[model samples]
Target: MKKILLIALIGYGGWQFYQKQSVAQPVTEPTVQVLPDYTVPLQKAREAASLLQFRCDGRQHCSQMKSYDEAVFFLRNCPDTKMDGDNDGIPCERQFNKG
Candidate 1:
């Protein structure tokens, strides 16, 4: 009976040691994904030109525009913009004139 108990304790201690060794493995950080160098600038330019730039939000007058480019964007993309009076595809002519 004593020998059986001793064998059981030894088995339990071996199992605990094995579990500790398995749990003590060194952790490694996950690998990071990198974009190509050429695509990085293109992606940044696209974000700067589109996502962080102008959006159509119900503004319809040339007086509400800050620049000619903004008025053109609104006139071309947004609905019901009154910037182009003659339908010549040019917007905000008085606000931003050609010299």
Candidate 2:
């Protein structure tokens, strides 16, 4: 009887292990992008071009950004941009992904 119980327990454990392994899991990873610094557009002929810079000091400009691209632009070029709350290279989580 003891031998039969042990065999049953081992079989049950193996079945549980197989069930765990058979379960499919979804893998998700946020795509990281390398963006370039942009310049403010000039409105005149031979106009002097200036680098796009903003002081993300007050009110946190990340939330005000229209899109993730703008957040990437400010975060890349501006020295004061603070869109990346976790400093994970990606920025504007709340605005971009509703994080």
Candidate 3:
């Protein structure tokens, strides 16, 4: 009887020790980084600012224009401007076109 009681006590103590050892510990999470968005190009902003220098004028033909940018602005905004000879979107292809 004493032997049986001793074996049972040893088994209970071992089970308690195992239960304490098997308990889980708390875990930590990793950090994350966020980035900003750039929707518009820098060149387009500069183009918009440069476009403010010109307005719709009655002047026609590429000869009256000082620069390629001025000729384009005249073609787009003003009427009766004989700049684009080929009827293409580009104005002053012979005068302003580099390529």
Candidate topping lDDT:
3
Q: Give the TM-score of candidate 1.
A: 0.51
TM-score of each: 0.51, 0.37, 0.52
Q: Using TM-score as the measure, name the better of candidate 2 and candidate 3.
A: 3
Per-residue lDDT over 1-99 for candidate 2, one digit per residue giving the tens place of the 0 to 100 score: 999999999999999999999999999999999899976655532222223333333334775787676676567666776678788888888777845
Backbone clash count, each prediction separately: 0, 0, 0
Task: Give the per-residue lDDT of model 1 (tens digit) for 22-79.
Answer: 8866789999999777656875786568634799999999889998778867877888
By summed lDDT, the worst window of 10 consecutive residues in model 2 runs over: 45-54
Better of 1 and 3 by TM-score: 3
Instruction: Give the per-residue lDDT digits (tens) of candidate 3, residues 1-99.
Output: 999999999999999999999999778787786778867789898778668998876889888888888888888888889988787778887787633
lDDT for 80 in candidate 2 is: 71
Q: Could you say which candidate leads in TM-score?
A: 3
Misplaced by over 4 Å in model 3 are 1-40
lDDT of 3 at 85: 78
Task: Give the C-alpha miss distance for residue 98 in model 3, angstroms.
Answer: 4.4
Residue 66 miss distance in model 1 (angstroms): 2.4
Q: Which ten residues in a row have the lowest lDDT in candidate 3?
A: 90-99
Better of 1 and 2 by lDDT: 1
